[model samples]
Target chain A: SAVISQKPSRDICQRGTSLTIQCQVDSQVTMMFWYRQQPGQSLTLIATANQGSEATYESGFVIDKFPISRPNLTFSTLTVSNMSPEDSSIYLCSVAPRLGNTQYFGPGTRLTVL
Target chain B: TQLLEQSPQFLSIQEGENLTVYCNSSSVFSSLQWYRQEPGEGPVLLVTVVTGGEVKKLKRLTFQFGDARKDSSLHITAAQPGDTGLYLCAGVGHNNAGNMLTFGGGTRLMVKP
Candidate 1:
C-alpha cells in the first residue's frame, strides 16, 4: 500500500475562484487518479494524471474545468478552475503502485464553493 | 456505459445484528473491489474479488463474487458501531484504461450501540 496525503483537507471558496489540491505520495507510482464525490453520492473518476504528460479526463470532464499536473512520479495536483456551487465536492487522489495492485487513496479534500 | 446498482441505500441496525449489501450490474466486470469510507475521509479498500464464484473472508466480513462476474455481495456478521460507514462497490471493466473504475451507489450503514 502507498501512503498518500492531500493538502487543504477542507476549504471554502467563493464562486469563480480557483483552488489547486495537491497530492503527495510516499513512493513513486505508475498511475495517479483524481476523483470527485458529491454530497450523498458515490465517487466519479475525474481524470488520470500522467507523469510528464497531459492528463486523461473522463467523459463529462474537460481539461479546462479540472486541470491536472503530474510533474513527477510521486506528486500531482488537480485544480478546480472557475469554481461554482455545483463543483462543491470531496476531491480525492489515489495511487496505483503497479498494475494489478490495489489503489490507495489519500484523505480527501472537502471543498465547499459558496 | 456499465453501471453498478447497490441495494438498501440506507441501513440502520443495532449492534450485533447481521446485514448484507448487494451490488448488481448487467455488464460483466473483470474484477470487483469493495471499500469502506468514514465521514470526511477517502475510501479504504477492504477486498478485491477477481474470479467468478470466488468467496473471500476477512474476519467477520465475507465477500462473494457472482459466477457471472457481474455482481457481488458483502455480508457482515455481528455488526459493530465501528461498522458505521458508507460501503461502495466498484467494477473494473475490460475496456477501461489505467484500471479505471465504475462505482455503484453506496450503501450507508449505521450501526447503533
Candidate 2:
C-alpha cells in the first residue's frame, strides 16, 4: 500500500480564478491520476498524469481547463483553471505503485468556487 | 463508454443489521475493487477481486466478483455506526492502460444506533 497526501485540504476560490492542488506519494508510483467528485455524485477521472509527458485526459475534460504536471514518480500537480461554480468539487489524487496493485487515494482537496 | 451502476443509492439500517450493495456493468474488467469513504475523506481501498467468481473477506465485509467479470457485490454483516459511509466499486478495463479505473455510482450507507 502507498500513502498519498494532497495540499489545500479545502479552499474557496473566486470564479475565474485558478487553483493548483499538489499530490505527494510516500513511495515512487508507476501511475498517478486526478479525479473530481461533484456533490452527491461519483468520481470522474480528470486525467492521468504521465511522467514527463502530457497528461491523458478523459472525455468532457480538456487540457486547457485542467492542466496537469507529473515531474517525477512521487509528485504530481493538477490545476483547475478558470474556475466556476460548476467546478466546485472535491479533487482527489490517486497512485498505483505497480500494475495489479491497489490504488491509494490522498485525503482529497475540497474546492468551493463562489 | 464504460459505466458501473450501483443499486440502492442510499441505505439506512439499524446497527447489527446486514446489508448488501451491488455493482453492475456491461463491460468486462480485468479487476474490481471496493472502497469505503467517510465524509470529507478520500475513499479507502477495502479489497480487490481479480479472478472471476473470486470472493474476498475483510473482517465483517465480504466482496464477490461475478463470474462474467462485469459485476460485483459487497456484503456487510453486523453493521456498526462506524460502517456508515459511502461504498464505491471500481474496475480496471481489460483494454485500459496504466491501471485507470472506472468508478461506480456510490452507495451511501447510514447505520443508525
Candidate 3:
C-alpha cells in the first residue's frame, strides 16, 4: 500500500472563491484518481489524473469547475472553482500502483463552503 | 457503467449481536474490496477478495466473495461499539481504466453497548 497525504486537511471558504486540494503519494504510481463524497452519501469519482497529460473527468463533472493537475507520478491537485454550497464535501485522492487493482487513499480534505 | 447494490442501508444492534452486509452487482468484477470509515476520516481498507468464492477474515470480521464474482458480503461476529462506522464495498473490473472503483451505496452500522 502507498502512503498518501493531502494538504490543508480541511478548510472553510466563501461560496465564490476557489480552493485547491493537493495530494502526495510516497511512491510513484501510474494511476491516480480524485473523488467527491457528499454528506451521508457514497463516493463519486471526479476524474482520473494521468501524469503529463490532461485529466479524464467523469460524467457530470466538468474541467472548468474542477481543474486537475498531475505533473508527475506521485503528485496531483484538484481545484474547485467558483465554489458553491453544493460543492462542500470531502475530496479524496487514491492511487493504484498496478493494473491488477486495489487502490490506496489519502486522508482526504474536508471542504466547507459558506 | 457497472453498479453495485448494497443492502440494509442502516443497522443498529447490541454489542454482542452479529450481522452481515451484502453487495450485489450484475456485472462481474476482477476484484472487490471492503472498507470501514469513521466519522471525519478517510476509509481504511479491511480486505480484498479477488477470486470467486474466496473468503478472508480479519479478527472478528469475515469477508466472502460470491461464486460468480459479482457479489460479496461482510459478516461480523460479536459486534463491538468500535465496529460502528460506514461500511463500503468497491468493485474493480478488468476493463476499468486506471484502477477506477465502482462503489456501492454503503451500509451504516451502529453497535450499541
* Residue-wise C-alpha lDDT for candidate 1, range B1-113, written one tens digit per residue: 89999988999999999999999999999999999999988899999999999999999999999999999999999999999999999998633346778899999999999
Off by over 4 Å in 1: B94-96
Candidate 1 residue-wise lDDT, A1-114, digit = tens = 899999999999999999999999999998899999999999999998999889998889999999999999999999999999999999999998986568899999999999
Q: lDDT winner among the candidates?
A: 1
**TM-score of each model, paired residue for residue:** 0.98, 0.97, 0.96
TM-score of 3: 0.96
Task: Go through the candidates in order and give the clash count of each.
Answer: 0, 0, 0
10 residues in a row with least lDDT, candidate 3 chain A: A98-107
Q: What's the C-alpha lDDT at position B92 in model 2?
A: 81
lDDT of each: 0.94, 0.92, 0.91
> Candidate 2 at A95: error in angstroms?
0.5
Best by TM-score: 1
B10-110 per-residue lDDT for model 3 (tens digits): 99999999999999999999889998888877788899999999999999999999999999999999999999999999998633355678899999999
Model 2, position A114, has a per-residue lDDT of 100
Off by over 4 Å in 2: B94-97
RMSD of each: 1.0, 1.2, 1.3
> Residues A1-114, candidate 3, lDDT per residue (tens digit)?
899999889999998999999999999988999999988888889999988988998889999999999999999999999999999899999998876657888888999999
Instruction: Tell me how each candidate scores on DockQ against the true complex.
Output: 0.75, 0.76, 0.65
